[model samples]
Target: MPSTRRRPPRQRHPELERDFVRTPALGYEDVDGSGLVRCLAHGFPSPLVRWHFHDEYELHLITHTSGRAFVGDWIGPFEPGHLVLCGPRLPHNWISFDVPEAGAPERDLVILFNHDPIARAAEQIPEMREVLQLLDRARHGIEFFDMAEAARMHWEAVRGARGMRRFAAFCDLLCDLSECTDYRLLSAVQMQGVQAEAQVDQINEVVNRIMARVNEPLSLAGVAAELGMSESRFSRFFRRATGNSFTEFVSRVRINSACHLLMQTDCFIADICFQVGFSNLANFNRRFLEIKGMTPSEFRRQAESRFGAG
Candidate 1:
């Protein structure tokens, strides 16, 4: 039977499109390798998906953008001016694009540093050992305090300098971060569920493909075949990973996309239903209500009311 529920978020971009090169082994040599402190790049792009991870410590200073920020399996509605520190190999991505008319995309800086030296530095002191352990969990990702003018200043300082002076400034930035008390670590894999990150990534990849083919009928066997897994195994794995059956996941994604279109674009509701992968209106209306706690028309009315107020 066709789905009758709103779909949740799905992957975007689908590839790491870095403007600067900063690998762990080569460090920032790909960009400017004159100093020992290699690997620092900044970004401020419109919200899009392409979930991937790297072996580096990443500091993001989002100046004026907010949405459903997904760091690993940790998902939430983030406010503007968000700062996050993600450790190595922990799959993470932002779903801010899914929000209807998400705020500004203008950002200040994004800093990425190879993890080896930072790990080695924390290894020397027993007292700071926990902080190093924190870095390990960062492998799963960290969502730190918002705005944080000081953190933004630090990012600017590290990126604007060179030589040993730059390294010292980077250290200062970390010290300030370590002293911060109001921050939250992301990804359940960081604290528990050892395979959580991998599981989420697998589900996300599947979800991305689903998004790419939203208009067509999806079959369990077909999806499993695409991912090279047997139908039964895929079913179990997906359920355990997302706590939603495959049917529920797809429905949520389609309807959520429909809602985004309704609020952000001038598309008709009937058009949006199919555009987001649903086959018809009844299913879309039912699913939209399930996920959003309101009917589709009600959702549109409320959104219009809010928009008018703003």
Candidate 2:
């Protein structure tokens, strides 16, 4: 049986902190170097486990333990073989529950690479363009399922090889991720292109306000009037810019905040409901079920597994 001891508490970092900034380890000269691709392995209690974002894309794989994963506005469970691709500047973190007091020596295998080089190379290399779509989807944080063994094998190939061989192995891994269909987009909303810069600014202001004041009441009519547009027009503009209706986007934001509290604190569900701006408990439960496919209590119960045995 797995140990039921609770793991030590980790220091919570601010949501927007741009942590883990460093130059990529260029492996072109060394026989065992990773070149443009930076490969990293670390344990659960290590400094690498934090809520932060970076300028490069990250391919993350779980090799041990179960825990809650926070990716952008998405929150869910992760176990061995779980894999995700996070685009540049998209914040993410994984907290393992099953770690022992001494800690597991290895919990994650990661690959970090930048998009500029690839995008530039694709301008001349048509074959490399296949990964462009994969990178775009990664902007919303892509979670791939049922490919753990293959991912580990590919990571090993890249880790052991160097120079052209290493690059080839990395490309092979990207090709597989690109073709994979058994995956889900983690973020609740995606930002599509808008018509004008002013429109983008207006919408961004509204979005910033919504996120900043998630606990406050937000009505489309009020926001539309503030933006000097009719409710109908604002609805169209909001949906186009955010891929979700105004109300739906607000609900997702609140629910996302509630999820963070659920995983990180022992607050009662009813208390959390009000804390996140829901006026009633039933409405909060319904919305949580609708979005997370679980009741708040059940979500917390499952989240406890991240600490190991329940």
Candidate 3:
């Protein structure tokens, strides 16, 4: 089993880089809505959060919102001043609510770039050899606090450059990241292998069902029935295919939906709970604390603190 971060979604052909090169996911383009973005740039409304992971290491320089960020098994609060570096293939998401505007764009700048270029550059430069090592760890992800400025400086360079210069600037940014000692890896990559003959595109139909009825009560049995599969078979099929069980997988996905609400609205937890499919307050609290490892209030407090300094 290869250990470096690379998982071709079922819709894509792993052997064909071009097939996965395009933003393969529906709605959430690898880039974004404009399509002109060489890198993805999205500014979500205060409440529009999505809990999703991808095949690339992502740098999220958050400004003007504070909330809990769930990366793998680690969860903590962050704010306008947060730097969330998500590892490739980890099931993670960030939750924020209407962050008070801080004279910057309301939507945070989410920059996505492929790891291959860094791999290419390191082969030619000894200065970046260590950086390559860091990236291998980054397959699990990393996070920095009070460090977006350092990253912002790098990002500004990348965002402003033109032609090959832009590409070079981005390379330099990776080197800069490699040099930082304060960074934390989310965890060593613990991803499962994709089945060689798995029918991923067909399964998206199931994923689509979850996405559409996320807020409503959804059961694995019902979903399987809708998909014309037997309950027991669907259970086994989902687990083998996704590296996740239907219940836990659905909960992970629901948490992601909750994150969007947390960042975009002033709605109370109870309301947000219902909005994300939990009907009881105790259950919501239990799940949030278990999944996020912080009480919602504590999570909020930490986020505010992080943003306060920013």
- The candidate that achieves the highest lDDT relative to the unseen native structure: 2
Question: What local lDDT does model 2 show for residue 213?
Answer: 88
Compared with the true structure, model 3 gives a TM-score of 0.48
Local distance difference test values of all predictions, in order: 0.61, 0.82, 0.61
Worst 10 residues of 2 by lDDT: 23-32
- Residue 39 deviation, candidate 1, in Å? 7.1
TM-scores, each model vs. reference = 0.48, 0.66, 0.48
True-structure lDDT of candidate 1:
0.61
Model 1 per-residue lDDT tens digits across residues 55-122: 66667666554555545444455555677887766545544343335443343356767766655766
What's model 3's lDDT at 194? 41
Tens-place lDDT digits, model 2, residues 50-83:
6677888999999999878878757688899999
Off by over 4 Å in 1: 1-30, 34-49, 95-105, 122-130, 189-310
